[model samples]
Target: MLRNWQEVLDLLAIIVKIPAALIMKVEPPHIKVCLSSHSHGNPYEEHEMAALGTGLYCETVMATRAPLLVPDALADPHWRNNPDVKLGMISHLGLPLVWPDQNIFGTICVLDGRENHYSPPFLQLIQQFRGIVERVLKQIYYDEVRVHEEAAIRADDAKRVRLEFAAIRDREQKALQAIKESKQRWHFALEGAGDGVWDWDMARNTVFYSKRCLELPGFPEHKSLVDFAEWERCPHPDDAATVLAEVQACLDGCIPAFANEHRVQAGGGWKWLLTRGMVVGRDDAGRPLRMTGTYSDPQAGRSRLAGTERPPGRTGRHADGGIAARHGTDRRHGKDGLAGPPGGRCGPRIEHAGGQYHPVIVEPEGSHRGYLRARRRQAADGQRAGRIPAQRQGRL
Candidate 1:
């Protein structure tokens, strides 16, 4: 485009019979020859510059936003000392180029080496080219604005996408944190209640046991079972079949849940436990996907039934106290010589003596039924003798 403007300057210089034809561009403090005619004897060179405010020909045209004609610089006192004299181009005729918004671009002009008045035809030619230059400036300005607008639109789209991804990530993190906290709360609650919690993943065939669950079976706190089969190994042989059947029934949707009192091997003996569980998740085909449950020592109820209290100074003992008391001995000869199965289902004798009700262990030689019958007869005899209250007789 600049080469084409050079050609235009060359043609104008030839047509006007001038030594120089130039396009001057303003750059604040100075104006430079942006293009110069290639004609012979044209002293001005492309990129030649002169400081503004120095009485230059182009400066006057730009300042007044109008044409400038200097017919004879040496003859005019106001123009004789201008910088163009050093180049020996004293005759000047120029027109200002302006943008569509009327801002000055610069001047397109012809300069001669001798005194000569520029003709009307020459002036008309300079004016026509000035209009062409201003049109090109307008087009360049609008093109740059369009490029900047497109860049800004792209930047906004990128910013929106980044913000959307950030929002999604933040939401996911919050949801995961909530799930973790919920599990912690459930774990603390179950452990506080003295229950051993368990979770079975049917698809993975894996069983996860809580710390209490491991402790219940005399396993190390850090011990981990690999699968449900390993957990099944903990149940007593006699109870394993029944326990598995009850669990399968729940999994098969035959029962709402599995609740069974069974024995599990712990230490060197067996401890009776009440295990309750239900299928918590299932597939569309009704097959169990996950099961959760808890195991609790059932001996606490038996201890209460026998009117026993937790022994003083025995902190952290199981609520039952029976498991610890019967640990290294036969259940028949357990604490206080309690005669019963390992579960403590029966054989502890309750008697109202010394003004308080308490349990007394009966010898295994006596049948449970015979002992109850003899106690009833003794209670009736006491009532007849006025030794027992009528209200207490019913309790006996």
Candidate 2:
């Protein structure tokens, strides 16, 4: 764009028969030659500057906002000592260029070394080119305004997006806090009830045991997590199949809840435990995702079923007594003939045989020692009774 303007100045100088033609710009206290004619003998160069208000020809045209012509600066007293005289440019013709806003931009002018009045034809030609320059300035000013407006709009959209994301983050933080608080309350309630708690995550096939739950099976209190395979090893071999089948039924939604009494291997022989649980969490397809349960000592309630004291001559005895007969004592007709609580009289008779403690039940007269021999035979034969095992025979 500026290259085209430089050509305009060059042609103007040739047609007007002048030594210099320039487009000058005002920058505060200085006036610069924005573009200078390319003709020979043209003294002014592009980008040359002179101090403003120094009686220069272009300065006068800008100050008055009109055309300026000087036939001979050496003859006119008003311009005789002007700075142009040093350049030997005595004759001048110039027109002021203004923006669309009516503000002075600069001057378009021609300067001559000889003293002669500029012709009207030359004056009209420069005036026509001045209109072209002002029109181009208008386009440049509008383009700058449009660019600034678009930048402002983009900044507003970015600010709105940042605010929306901040709002979403705040909501998620509140929800997580609420969930944490609820879990704390649930754990507190379960612990206070004196029940050992267990939580199973089906998706991960892992189980988490509370401190009390670990202690129930003679495990360390700090041991909290176990894999499914490890947990399956806890139940006694005789009871494992039934316990597992009951648990699977509940998980498959066939039963509303799981309640089973099973024997689990403990440090002190086998211990009977009552475990109750349900599917506490499920997926969208109704498949179990998580389960929670409690382990409780059921022996406390079964202790009352050990039977009341028999008559003086009567002995509570049955041939098909199964495992319960082996665990219970006949207080009336035994060799000791001691009448008292069932477990109190019968509990001390646990005999160490075949690598495990076998509880020997004292039957009626003539069968007391015979029953002991039979129990030893059963232990040797690896025969197991189906009734629930007792942790403490007297209490349960």
Candidate 3:
């Protein structure tokens, strides 16, 4: 019935078309059939375990790696006294259940109601049945290996999601919890998140802004990031149109999420940044009413092109011994009186859009940065920030 050894064993028993079939494998104490399609065969004791020993059917099949067919179980003097016949089996056909490795580990058998049922056609039928048994054996082995692989994958992905949720959930407290937690734990995510963390409430028609967010051109402070056109305010002219389009899609009640990483002005030149905001809460109609995510600079990612640090921006060490960004726009005040590359302003290497990573960039003010969207602080009612995070500190 099925190419699966587990299923084929049970199917062979009552194939009314074929008197009886049994599927048995080796263990230790006795020859026990795992699956039987009809009541004509033996079902071993609950605690019984099978073994490949002196048992005729099992031993012969295991030793010769072939099928044993006897059309008349009672008349054959060679096997008449055999336990199988003594047990009242009148006729029987046994096919070795061989694995892909050519190991005869079990048997698929059919018992007949009459003598001499082992005709050419019936023998051929048993041979055909053997084909199914062999394949099912192979599949059983394959399924075991496949199961291991799938379990490994599930474990790895679950670990990643678990960590991500842990981080995101950290934002439950202090309005600035996301910033404090990142600095304390990852310390490098700021470099990957790009700049200007923001929150948009589609239903309330309000958007929350941060200091660095105000620095990005497309949106103004204490006011809507859009006024007939939000694109004009975006520092990166190239990405403005797409950003606006994504914004509308996120707010249209069609899609409850939006995320984009593109270049934007940071006091001077364009720098890469990752912005992620998802609907933290939704309405009855499945519409997104609120969203929140982090925004940080990604200078370190830009520096590690091809694992070769390209000397860009300017070279001045932070008081904490971090390199001053040599490229891109960095408007943050530095101890050396130079604007270092803005932290978290570099996007992911190439087009790798999704991944949680943090690169250590120490700021003079005692903060580190990287890219990661961990859990937000647990709101008394379970909510996120009412304002954006503070600017990058030391370890740049």
The reply for model 2, stretches above 4 Å from the true place, is 53-55, 100-104, 189-396
- Models sorted by lDDT, best on top: 1, 2, 3
Q: By lDDT, who's the top model here?
A: 1
State how far residue 360 of model 1 sits from its true place (Å). Answer: 51
Q: Which tens-of-lDDT digit does each residue in 1-396 have in candidate 3?
A: 333644554454534355456666665556666666634444332234545454456567666777776777567777776666655666777767777766656776666556745567656766787786676668888898799999999999999999888777665565477668765454244423445555655444456666565644333455434332232244343333334434444444444555555555544455555455555776776555566655554453441211122234422222122122222222233333443333323211111112211122222221212111111233343665343343442211
**Residue 313 shift from truth in candidate 1, angstroms:** 36
TM-score of each: 0.58, 0.57, 0.34
lDDT assessment of candidate 3: 0.50
lDDT per residue, candidate 1, 1-396, as tens digits? 787788888898888788899998998898988998998898888998788888898888998988988999999999999889888988998889887777788889889999879889877877888878887899998888889999899899899999999999999999999988998888889888878889988667778889888876567765554576677676554344345545655665667776666566777666667787888998776667888998887655332212232233321112233222325432223334434333322223223354332333333323333334444677878743222211111121
| Count of backbone clashes, every candidate in sequence | 0, 2, 67
Across residues 211-283, which tens digit of lDDT does each residue of candidate 2 receive?
7777666677656898766776676543443455446656667667766665566664666666777789887
Error of 3 at 279 (Å): 41
lDDT of each: 0.69, 0.68, 0.50
- RMSD (Cα, Å) of candidate 2? 13.9
Q: Candidate 1 regions off by >4 Å?
A: 195-210, 223-396
